[model samples]
Target: MKSLLRLTLSVLIISLVACSILQREGRYFSHPSTISKVDAIGSIPVRISLEQNWTDQTRMDFWFTSQGSRIIPYSWFMWLEQADSRALFRDAGHMEQLRYLPVASSAVNPAGLPIGFALDTDTQTGDAWLGLTCAACHTNQLDYQGTKILIEGAPTLANFVLFYQRLVNALTVTGKDDAKFERFAKRVLASDYSAESAAELRNSVLQISLAVAQRQLVNALPATYPADFTSYARLDAFGNIQNAASAFALHDLTNRNPPTAPVSYPFLWGTHQSDVVQWNASAPNTPIVGPLVRNIGEVVGVFGDLSITEAPWWQRVLGKKNSYSSTVKMLGLGHLEAWVKDLRSPQWPQQYLPGIDATKAAQGSVIYQQQCASCHQVITRSDEGQDYIAVKTPLIEVGTDPAMAWNAAHHKANTLILEGTKKDIIVGDKFSVQAPAIELAVNGVVGLVLKNPGEALKAGLIPEEHGKRSLLADELSSIEDYLQVNLAAREKLTVATKAASLLSESELHGLVYKARPLNGIWATAPYLHNGSVPNLWELLQLPEERIAEFWVGSREFDPVRVGYRVDQGLSKFRVRDDGGEVTPGNSNLGHRYGTELSDQQKWSLIEYMKTL
Candidate 1:
């Protein structure tokens, strides 16, 4: 009986492993090796003709600069593998297979890590770590007749959820398999390889793996609803950031909420001057504190280390206030913001794609003035000091997906241990047990800024107009003003939740999705705030006439439609919009503004938009 049981257990383990592999195989579609190579012979460098202050070197810096986010230890990421195979996980070929843009090995990126993957080192400990930079989600590439055209600041088709899941699986396998652990240890500690060192490394891997698994559990979308799953080009950034700040940082697991509202990554070209950022327009772009605070929250969400601990007895006795400690690189964030100011929107590559018909474009210009100009205002891409504010179209008016905007406005969390903590460590009131997730995030940012005031100042946290700045006085005032603006915006959103009868037109506008300038709208497609409508042609159709379901994760351009070719390519992730409860976050409804136009007029408008 004992011999039979041992054989049965062995068979069961093998069966389970086989099933896991099959599941992953079904979910992820690997691209062919040929697809990774750019056919440079016929390719044209696609970019706007407008001259900017920054050079290509500056662009590369923006692509690779680290923001102190440590997704995993540097050695582990360098030598990790897939859960089921000996193949390296971060291999350039494997990353390309997953749709991550490949970068050649260089001094700046000696490992030849994919674009946006960077090395971050601890200033005090001299320990190196591996993490993602902004380019991971923002850089894009399109295939036009086998020639690849790189578009900076455009949304990438990389599968973020799959990438993270694979990493977690790799860590788990390395911890369990003795052979894998031995190999990983040897590579990580080549000079000091020993049983003792291997054991230590294994423990560290297991602990980190366990922590990552817990986070995935807390943030995972409902399995019952397929629409909530984040595929290529979309992420519920707000939800994830909230969970990171209020749940993980505070060590309150119950405070977690599933990240269900996935939206396309917005292009960064004109974001520097926009009055507000984000799909829901939740973040106000105040001068000094605005962009810095927003970037800090993003880094924290993306594996940046943040610890909220009780103040030491000596400090409490000495009247030194408590503040959250974080690994966010403040100066690095400032540099990124400055670089973004110089980014120009990409124009139509007439050489590769079909040229715009001048006559149709002229006709479309008239239609644009009548239909689109009110919301998506025309802008001069070359203007340095252009003041462009995104028009906040109310949910009831534009009627796209409401999940993202709704959650941002109303998601509340239990403050737990943070109940009585100062709302702002430098100066402000205390928090209550029940607070909005945005409030908690703001408090976390404020605490981190106060904890490192010198770095914050050097990072340009104060406006230059506030000359001869006192760290405590000017910085605190600016932060407070910024905080008030955020809080006031949140308040409007909260109150707007009341019955329509009780709401004024202005109050109703609080629940909105911002209509941004469409300078590069042709390049950033899968239209609407939710990214449900696949292409411009379908976007101009009535809600019911639009494609009910389509595949995403393709880089092949559909020049005629001005979006990616949705019929097929690398990934098989289906984006559905059946207009039912099952597809809450993926609804391709509303935005009925120009659906009544003639087909010829619609085509004309699309032609004109390519010129923008």
Candidate 2:
């Protein structure tokens, strides 16, 4: 036994020594080393060439003419430049207040944090080398909130180069060229612009930065505006700013260029819409956010040679200096385009459980008409003269505000019966459903997020469809029957309707009005018909009363503007110029979460609604 014990001890000691040696020397994850050491080992600096049809001349033409095809990605050099600048613009816009007047430095993403790297090696820079890769945008610095939560991107907007110039200009205008200005500009903007002369201003890096920022903003619009876009801002008979036609409309794919308004602007489609609100957990989705400047540092970082190590297959293909030489790069680019094609793809509802009750809904319907019908008519094709959010009067914070408390009063419409005692309201026995299958359909719809990535790409995953499809015909009939008899009939419910004071038809579709629905309904946020809105939850929270917030040019939801939301990397901002005073697809639309209900009525209705 003693001999056996000695042998075991010796074996253990030998094993420990072997492990220590292997830990120090092994190439595969040698603690101090890196995963790259074993998994992949080649550095490939990407090489880019302008697509044959695209030349530097084309880029110049694109700028002055605003030509469609000429300005877009088919021209490899232009595309690369545009993509990088775009990434940078978003960073800058978010980092600083680009839209609002009191444009202040952001507390989230501070100044420069390695947003873009200019490749400048001998024999490795020039027109062919001057394009942006993945690292241009999309990279995020996780801001440490605490041990559990980490938020990424600080002063989360543009880089120091862009922000500094902007700061200098604003400061020069305000004449607050005090010590703070100097310190802020030098520390944050990182540019020198103290000359009092006009020539000095012109010669300063500040000027160059401003020029770049201006060009970047203009270039953010896609090369081709869809035909549906309409122009609204124009010179009226009075020679003042008047909405004449839709500012942006969709056009043919083969159009010579994106249609121009005397005053051009991006279509705010993909902005928040109400159609998808049934999706709650379905709020902000991560897939919606594409690359920020730093998103793909690994993919777009300085490549050492014509080789790929830690890249997806496609990046590896693009990394090959000869990628364009081989058709492989083309194939890879095509695939990548498809993936990015639906950046604002509607992520199906994560939990679309519309589970509305019928019997209580039946009883509740009567209350809905008495209280809500005056404002939110069940009448068919009714046109209330308010934008979606405006008419709904959606408050930014639900439970936080006394008037617009979302959780405090859910069933004001009386469709929802508060079942519990006065202390705490419970709502199960108040409303009963003839069919419980609504939850099944809602579930199925919500399940799609996990089920069909392909269908989502096609934009077929509407939350309403799930509601309509989820319930059986009888179930819908019951719910509709309850609503119609309760809310639609206009008998003695002598409630005075609030007449909407609207701008003219042209004005309604004008840039200002067309932009109404986009305030803060992030559930449906994404590229409108023009692929404009990018943040899902952010769309829902847009404070329409504050016009400048809409102009931030990036998608982010503010709870102060939108009452409810969840963060999941949502995307989109599509707007339909529904001709009525309100935006499109919203009329006496089906009553889901009956917005027609007053604040109190909505509380009652929502309370009753949750039981369903």
Candidate 3:
């Protein structure tokens, strides 16, 4: 009887663990929606046709869908069954916050994938792998009653923290399952393997999965990061990149700082034309080099082939190194950048929303020019018939929350290692390129190397290009050999050199934010650098009157408020006064422009802004 009970208990434990592995929910199925085809309805003038727009969307779809060799082989996520992956997706609770859209067809993506995910073939291994793209965080949808508004430039609402947590949980659960081991091994390593090889591969995958899960656990401990380190829609964009790049290059996880410097994702619309981009106005915004470096940085952040590990070098030398593959598709990235330049600001749907009062808008336009034009107006220049926006990188002190600026000012690149030596470069950490000309030189030369490895080999660029690979200028030479090879690249390099000539070396470290042209300002809300304010109306109020605490992450449009509706209870952010100074990154203080204006004046200003 005792032996029978013991057997029964063992059977129950197996069933429970099996159920945990098998249970899948929240699987997304693609369904066609008319949201993409909706008319601009007297918004901004579109340069491209709706069909062409759809084609651009298609290009965007491909860009977002194609896996760029980010993340690791045999991730716990790769082992998850379709149902289980879906369950993890659903459990993340991002349906409303991130405003995920349904896809049009199963033919486009198998497993009924959501907007952000698509199966990509590993270039070397010829195996299918899942990776993330720009759409996961960049694409946004707003529900205006029954109408769905698709805005591409606004910050994402997805809860990445939760998604990461679910992934860790999946890894933890999978690690404890002996029965699931064979299936995971076949899927990740090899289907037809000798018993010995399979055992080794299974153990390798387990080791990787377990290590990742352990890291996730360690990161979740409150002591790992700041107590106030909570990322909702906004992420510590620069800090995460720094940490990831450091981790990838060094393979030393202990030194990586937690991505605690959270800031709102700046909208991309009209950014290509800016003088200097990034929230902190750190990078040079030259047409050729700016976009190239920016995209490279982005791809690296998103897990593209930016790994400088020995494995990538080995793969580059040989065809494949074990299961790892690294390919930097520079031309493809150039195409993506060129495509993004065509993206126009979203037009305010005057027909769908309440039509703007034109007369009042005119009056507000007068007020805008009087009170706001000095800072917000676009500066243009024409030299010998060539016209361009004069990059006016003015650091205005409008008394908005200075935390982002402070954080930017204080941050340093302490962990970066110098190439060909154990010496680490003691450089100021920033989101922008520190030396624009140097960056262009490096990118132009290195980009060519990555583009044509055979030519690079023939040209004897192996040592210089591959010997000490990094994002710095030490390994890159200013000599004619690499730079003079490509005329177009050289010309662009010259152009970048001239564009950054006016910038002083000290200016590169300036923590000032760029005042972007307010073309579609009404569409992007939760104003201020940190996205602390919830609406334009609130933004116009005095610093004291602005709600000290509020929540973010809702797509329900409050057209009158000129921002997404925020419910204090349901919102993702809750700024509290802990009696001590508000956390540096979380403060809702400053940027009190136009606070002295009357209610009617503020509304009129908002109305005028919608037309721009």
- In the range 429-491, model 1's lDDT, one tens digit per residue, is 677877778678777887787676667756754333323333433445544555555455544
Candidate ordering by lDDT (highest first) = 1, 3, 2
TM-score of each: 0.85, 0.23, 0.69
Candidate 1 residues lying further than 4 Å off, grouped into runs, are: 1-53, 318-321, 422-429, 461-509, 571-582
Best by TM-score: 1
For this target, which candidate reaches the highest lDDT against the unseen true structure?
A: 1
lDDT of each: 0.72, 0.22, 0.50
Candidates in descending TM-score order: 1, 3, 2
Score candidate 1 by lDDT: 0.72
lDDT of 3 at 413: 34
Candidate 2: where is the Cα deviation over 4 Å? 1-94, 98-123, 126-594, 597-612
In candidate 1, list every pair of residues with a backbone clash.
none
Q: Backbone clashes in each candidate structure, one number apiece? A: 0, 121, 8
- Of the two candidates 2 and 3, the one with more favorable TM-score, higher being better, is 3
lDDT of 3 by residue, 1-612 (tens): 546534543443344333323212211111122011222111221122211122655544543545353343322243453224423232223333334444432444443344566455544444344556666666566656666666765566666665565555555455556555556555444334567756665554455455444335323423534433554567665655554444433334443444555677676556655556567555554433445555555655555533333336665486422121234344455554444444556667765677888998898899899878776773321111121343333333554445444434433332323232211111112223132212222332234344454433333322123223323234435322333333333343234333434545334323356576676677776677677788888888887677776666676778887888777324456454456456556666667668899999999998888776
